[model samples]
Target: MQAGNLVLLLVALGAVFYFFGWRRSYAVSAPLGGVRHLHSLPGYYASLAAVWCVLPALALLGLWLIIDDAVIRTNLMASLPSSIQPANEVDYNLLLNQIRNVAGGALNPAFVPAEVVAAAEQLVAMQARNQQMMSIAFVSIAVLGGVWGWSRVQPRLRARQQVESVMKWMLMGSATVAILTTLGIVLSVLFESIRFFQKVSPVEFLFGLQWSPQIALRADQVGATGAFGAVPLFAGTLLISFIAMCVAVPVGLMSAIYLAEYAHRNVRAWAKPILEILAGVPTVVYGFFAALTVAPAIRGFGESMGLTVASESALAAGLVMGIMIIPFISSLADDVITAVPRAMRDGSLALGATQSETIKRVVIPAALPGIMGGILLAVSRAIGETMIVVMAAGLAANLTANPLEAVTTITVQIVTLLVGDQEFDSAKTLAAFALGLMLFIVTLGLNVIALKIVKKYREQYE
Candidate 1:
């Protein structure tokens, strides 16, 4: 049976066990002055039986699925003639792909050798047999587990505690998986970054002023000396992020304050969602706007004012990015401000403070930590934005702070380095990992700073 169908069958079996266990508990308790004689609730007994019926069967199904494909592939490879056997891992993978294609009727059998066609037939047969065996095993396990759990139901059984313990372990397992997944990602990136650092010095990658990463394979290649200096990228990133924040912070904060304190009920009901609609608009659409409309306007205005502005300027990208993230800051700040205790405001007003003074001194201070966190999140969003920057800000690694100049960011460089046909071992490609590691570190530092600020403000208020 298919995995989905098998899972459904297991669930049905578990449901049957649940009913049986519930009935058995009631049947056993009825003789001893009803269910009052039982140690735990009937629902807990039913849940414990359902868990017993499902867990072991699902575990077996998972293990079989993991090993089935490898075993099948290995047996197929063994059956192939020595002369036709693949010489390397890549060649073996290719051979297996062709076999799969033939088995699935994607490849015409008459065009290929008879050996390949025969192997495809064998593969189909083995898979059918494997599925049959798996279905039988899964059904048997589920049935046996259901019977055992039903038989185990007793008057004094602590089925509630047992079910709770199982759920607790399941939750812990889920948390462990999440933590391990994050660690795996970090370790993979860190290892690749270490390899990159061995090829290019960390000092040069971090502190050097230029950012070219094209390593030449031949001596005659031009402009491929691979200057891995990341300073220009960092400067451009900070400059654009600063411009975005300049536009976003005050506007978003003021909007939040107004929405939270001054807006009418009916107005707020419609206004908040409409305002936050910007967050739902795709970043690519913002990029298109930045590239087609904003960039041209800025360039045209600059030329009219006798200033030289690049066609793709940082100002255009930053402005659009700021507009895009405004919803993020405003929504978060509005929620935080509204969450402040109504009693605090009432107390402030009772102390002969004006509404404006109460908002500025009382409400703002109480909500400061959350507002700051929202701003920090917006700043991170600005730094990590790629599409608008790529479309509006041209990929020129010029180390100038001018918003009118075209520049590139770390993410842009990372994308550029890894694009097209590139060898993984080359410094050009490895440099992408180095850039990623740098970006990760910078973001981590920002998070640390945000946490410290939040903690300080929270302590002061509390």
Candidate 2:
């Protein structure tokens, strides 16, 4: 049976065993004092039985799914002739894909080697055997576990304690998995960045102004000694982000204040969702809007005013990106503002303070931490945005503070560097990891600053 079907069967079997446990608990209670004398409620006993019936079988099913492909591939590869065996991991994967396609009838057997066809047949047989064994073991364990739980279901059984303990362990396991995944990603990026730093001096990469990363094919080619200076990229990123924040912060925050404090309930209900609809629009759509519509408008306006504006300028991208991320700030701000205690507002009013005064003095200060959090999230969203920047801001690593100039960000450069079949051995490819590490550092610094601000304001307000 398939894993999905087996899971469904186990769930149904657990339900049945739950009823058995509940009924048995009542029967045992009836002889004593009709459930009043029982150690725990009937529901707890029912849950215990369900846990026993499902958990062990589900564990086996999960284990089987994890290792089933490996076991089948091992058996099939063992049967292949030594002469035709894959020499490396990449070759093994390619051969396995070929065999899988042929076995699934996506490829014709007449077009391939006889050995591969034979291996495909063996693959099919092994999978069928594995499935059969999995189904049997899954069902048997569920049945035996249910029986064990039912026999153990006496008035003295601490079913509630056991169930709660299992739940606690499950939560801990989930938290551990999250922590490990984050650690693994950080280690992977850090190791690759170390490799990149070995190729280029960290001082040159950090302090040099030029940002050309195109690795040359010939020794005599132009820019053969590619400049990996990240200063230009950093300047462009900050310039664009600053422009975006200027547009987003006041507008989004004011709108949020209006919606949360002053707007009628009906007006807020419709307006907030319509405003947040911007967030739901895909980044590619925002990119297209920035490229075709906003960039041209900005360039035309600049020319009319005798200003030098690139066809794709930071101003255009930043404006559209600001519009894109407005919902992030607005939504979170509204939520936090609304969360301020109503009594505080009432108290302020009773003290003769106007609603605006109360908001400026009491509400905003109290909600400063959450407001800062929202702004930080919006800043991260703006910094990480690649599509809008790529579309509207032409990929020029110009170290300029002027928003009218075309410029590129670290994310855009990273995408450009790692777009195709890249040789990881090259400094060009490893530069993406270095850029990623820098981005991580910047984001962490932002979080630290925001946390300190939050802590200071939070203490003062509290």
Candidate 3:
């Protein structure tokens, strides 16, 4: 049977067990007076039986799928002629892929040697047998588990406690999986970054002024002497992010403040959602707007004002990116500002302070921690944005602070370096990992600072 069909069958069986256990519990309790005399409800017994029927069956199915491919490949290789055996892991994988393609009818048997055709036939037979065995075993186990659980359903079964215990452990397991996944990502990047630093000095990568990353393929190749200096990239990222923050902070905060404090209820209801709709628009759409509309407009305006501007200028990208990130700042700040105690605002006003003065002093100070966190998150979003920067800011890693000139960010270069057929051993490709590590560290630092700010100033009013 197919995996999807088998899963459906398992679900059907679990449902059967659920209803059976529920009715059985009532039947068993009838002789003992009523269901009120039972230790747990009929629903708990039903849930317990369902869990028993599904858990072992799902576990076996998962295990079978994990090992089935390797077992089939091993047996297939054993049946091949000694001379036809693959030489290395890469060749072995290639051979397996060809076999899979042939077995799945994607490749014609006449195009390959007779030995491969024979192996493909064996692969198909083995897969059919494996699926048959797996289906039989899983169904048998699920039925046995259901029978066992149903037989135990009685006045004193303690079904609720058992089901609740299982659910609690499942929830904990889910949390552990999330934490481990995050740790795994960090370790993988850190290890690859270590390898990258082995090829290039940390100091040179961090502090060097030039930003070329092209490694020469031949000694005679001109302008390919790779300079791994990252200063220009860092400077460009900071310059664009600073410009974005400048545009975003005042506008987003003011809008948030107005909605939270001064806006009429009807106006707040409509305007807040309309403003947040900017966040829902895809970054690529924003990128297109930056490239075609914003960049050309900035260049034309600069020309009109007798100022030089790159055709793809950072100002255009930064401005659009700021516009893109406004919702992040506005939404979070609005929530935080609105959460400030109404009594605090009233108390400030009761002391002869104007409404604006109360907001500037009493409300903002109390909500500043959360507002700072929102701003930092917006800044992080600005730093990590790629599409708008790529579309508007040209890929020149110029070490300049001028927003009218073209520049590139670390993320843009990382994408450039690893976009195509990249050899992992090359410094050019490995540099992406190093750049990723730096970006991760920078983001982590920002989070830490935000957390500290929140901790230090949180609940001052309370």
Candidate 4:
């Protein structure tokens, strides 16, 4: 059986074990007159049995999957002639890929050396044998665990405590995995960024004001020089984000206020969903909209007003991006505004304040922290948008503050740098990691500032 099928079978066996454990609990309790005489409920006994039946088997299955490929590769290399043995990691990877392709029938064996053909056959046979052994071991362990758990089910058994302990450990493992994954990402990006800085001076990359990354990594291949300066990218990112915030904050916050405090329940129900649906629209669709419709309209409008707007301008991208992030602010703000105590609204009204005044003074102040968090999220979303910016705000790395001009952001440059086949060790490619690190730093600063604002406002409300 396949590993996935084996997992399904194991789950079915665990369910069967749970039923037996549950029935045994009731049988033991019936002799004592009722379940009240038992240390734990029948359901707890069932859960404990299920956990024992599945957990050990699942653990073994996961371990088997992790090591099986390495074992296969080791045996394959050992069986090969010394002449066929790979001398380095790169050679080994290339040779293994050829073998895999042949084994998978993507490549014909006749095209490769006889040794490769033999290795491909060996690879297939080993995989089949491994799956056979894995399935048998997985099933036997599951059955043994189920029988053991069932045999241990007694009226005095601390099933609830055992099950809860297992659950707590599982939750802790999940949290640890999350923390480690985040740490790994940051370290990887940081290390690569450091490598990039070693190749290019930090001062030139950070402060110099031109943005051309077309220079070849090798001097032999069209290498005049690439400008490593990121000032323009940073300026463009901030300019677009600022414009987006100007559009989103007022519109999203006011709509949130109206929905929470003034709109009829039926109006709110439909309006909120409609607004959220707008948010759920695919970003690629937004990109196309901006490219074809919004950008042209903005340019035309600017020209009509005796302004020289680029066909693909920052204003178009920012405006479309603002519309895209509206639900981020509106939904969160509406929820927080609605969460304010009803008595606060009533007291303000009793003091003869208008409904608008009550909402502004009472509800909004109370919800300021959450509103700030939502705006921060929207700002992040706007800054991170690559498609809309690429499609509308053309990738001209121009360092102008005017919304009428074309500009590009760090994300667009990162995507461009990493898109095609390029030398991984090249400064041009590594520049992506450096830009990513800078973007991360800017986002971290935004979070710190938002948190301080939230903390200050939260104190008054709490």
Candidate 5:
């Protein structure tokens, strides 16, 4: 049978066994007359029981299947003859891939050496035997486990309670997995950043004013030493983010107010998603728009006002990024505004307050926490944005905050630092990790603060 058909058969058998047990329990008890016991749960409990039993086991089976190939390949590498092994780690890795492809029947025999071919054949045979044995063992275990679980069911089993507990644990496990993944990522970045810090002193990297990252490609090249000072990059990030917030906060909040409070339902239906479409446009498209359209316009407008503006300007990039983040702020603000209780509005109106007054004094204050949360998130996004700044804002890492001048951001610098072929252990490449670490920390701190504010707001409502 096909694998899918076999799975279906096993599921059907498990279901049959579960219902059979449930029916036997009911038959023995007959708590009330045939259908008179209103408290007795319906026969669907059997199906739920079958799902609970089968799903976990099947999940384990699926995980094992996914990992089995990698495990087998690693084992086969460990079994390779010392004479056949490549000299260096990189070459050894190349040989391992060739052996894997040959073993998996993806490579022609002519392409493989005799030793490799012999080893691949033996490994493939072993893997096939192992898989066959594992499959049989898994099926047997699943059947036995399902039968055991089903047999425990009775009139007094409290199956619903047990199911609920299991569901709660499943949800907790899912949450733990998400948290663990995030923690793992942070730890990895932190370790790499520490390595970078060892090469470049923290004080110099953090406080230095110059931001040039270009390094000598050859030993004899002579030039001014590349400075790793990060202040200018961070300053640029903050300047852009500030400009973006200035543009986005007012426009987004006002738009949200109109949509949530004043607009008719049909108008809202059309307008909200239309506004969100701004968010759907890719950042690369926004980058070019900022570079080609916004930048030139800003320069021309600046010249007309007798102010000098670079052709590639931070203002243009910031403005475009602000536009990109408007939906984030407005959508969240709208939700928070709408969540204000109808009773609060009625009470204000009854007290002779105008709609505008009521909204300003009561609704906004109530929704302030959620709105702040959204703004914080927007700031994080603006700080981390790369494409727009890289294309529209010039790479000159000006430490000044003048919007007319060019500036570089942390993300842009990180990209430049690591973009071309370079040694991973070099100070230049490792500098990217340090920048990444700082970015992660800043964003994480913002999120935590936002969450705390939002949580406090929720408590007020509750």
Candidate 6:
């Protein structure tokens, strides 16, 4: 039978078994003065008894069904004939795939061997019979266990409390999975970065001013050098991130203010989602628009104003990244602003302050922590951004403050390091991990500070 049908059958059998068990228990517990003298309400008592046995037994059966295929496949692999054994790991896996497909009646004509075909047919027949018998046994056990448990239930049983305890443990298990997943990712990144640091000195990687990653391909090659300096890339990253923050913070904050305080209800409803549409645009699309459209425009504008600008400039990339981040800042700012108590706004308005004045002097200061938190998050995004800088900013590592000049960022360098085929142990590849570690540290530091500030603000408000 199909899996769904099997499940339904199990459930139907469980319900029938529960009802019969309830009746048997009730008959046994009936007092001398007929059914009127029974200890509790009949249906509640019945359901309580039924739940103790039916749910647990059925759950176990379902778990078995889910794992049965893996168990059977493992056993079948061990039982395969010595003559048909695979020559290597790859061939073994291929044999297993063929066996599975043939047993499932999904084999193609290309690679069918006569002995393998016979073996598959035999295995399928055996597995089908085995599964059918297992299902029947499971249903029987569920029904019998339900009856047995119901017969044991008494008026003093604390069934509700027992069920609640089980549910609580289930929730804890779910929470543990989520927490473990986050910890696993952090540990993986940390370990790889540690491996990278073993090969290169931390001081040299972090403080050295030049960043040339090309290294010798062979032991005999001469005049090949690899510099692990990270300062220029980080400087470029900071410069671009600062420019992005400059563009995003003011625009996002003002847009948030207008939407939250000043705009008409209809206008706010329509305009907020429209502005947020920018966030949904894919990063790759933004990259090309930065490279093909915005970079040229910036260069042209600079030339028209009697200034020299690089064709691929940091200003263009930062501008586009800032536009990309505006929704992140504005959406978060809007939430925090709206969360500020209406009574505060009313109090400021009652004291003869204009709406703009109240927003600037009172509301904004009250919400400053949250706004700063949003800006920090946007900064982290800017630092981590790769595609826009790769496409628009030139790869030259120049340590300069001028936005008009082309520069490379840590993310751009990381992308270049691992883009095509290369040895994983090489300095070029290891440099990516070092850069990633630094990027993680910087973003983590910002987040910690932001969270602390936000916490303090919340405590004060409360």
Indicate which candidate wins on lDDT.
2
Worst 10 residues of 4 by lDDT: 215-224
Writing each residue's lDDT as its tens digit, candidate 3 over 120-185 gives 999999999998998899999999999988888988989999999999999999999999999999
Which is the better candidate, 1 or 6, if ranked by TM-score? Answer: 1
The clash count of every prediction, one per candidate, is: 0, 0, 0, 0, 0, 0
Candidate 3: which stretches are off by over 4 Å?
31-34, 81-91
* lDDT tens readout by residue for model 1, 1-462: 999999999988999999999999999999998998999999988888888899999999999999999999999989998877999999999989999999999999998878889899999999999999999999999888888888889999999899999999999999999999989988988999999999999999889998888777887898557799999999999999999999999889999999999999899999999999999999999999999999999999999999999999999999999999899899999999999999999999999999999999999999999999999999899989999999999899999989999999999888888889989888889888888888888888888988999999999997
Which residue runs does candidate 1 get wrong by more than 4 Å?
12-16, 87-91
Model 2 lowest lDDT segment of ten:
75-84
Error of 3 at 95 (Å): 3.3
Write the residue-wise lDDT of candidate 4 on 149-239 in tens digits: 9888899999999999999999999999999998999999999999999999999999999978787647777645788889999999999
Write down the lDDT of every candidate, Cα atoms only: 0.92, 0.93, 0.92, 0.92, 0.83, 0.82
lDDT of 1: 0.92
Give one digit per residue, the lDDT tens place, for model 6 in 1-462. 655776687667667656765685467556544434545545555665566556666676678778887887777777778788889999888988897788777986357886677668767876887678777776666666676667665655554465467668879989999999978877776777777778778898889898888888775766266788889998899989988888999999999999999899999989999999999999989999999999999999999999999999999999999999999999999989988898998999999999889998878888988898998899899999989898898798998899999999988898898898978777778788778878888989999999998889878766
lDDT for each residue of candidate 2 in 113-134, tens digit (9 for 90 to 100)? 9999999998888888999999
User: What is the Cα-based TM-score of model 4?
Assistant: 0.96
Assess the local accuracy of residue 299 in candidate 3 as a C-alpha lDDT between 0 and 100. 92
- Against the true structure, candidate 6 has what lDDT? 0.82
Q: After the best TM-score superposition of candidate 5, give how far the Cα of residue 67 lies from its true spot, in angstroms.
A: 7.1
Q: Which ten residues in a row have the lowest lDDT in candidate 1?
A: 217-226
- Clash pairs, model 6 backbone: none
lDDT of 2 at 139: 100
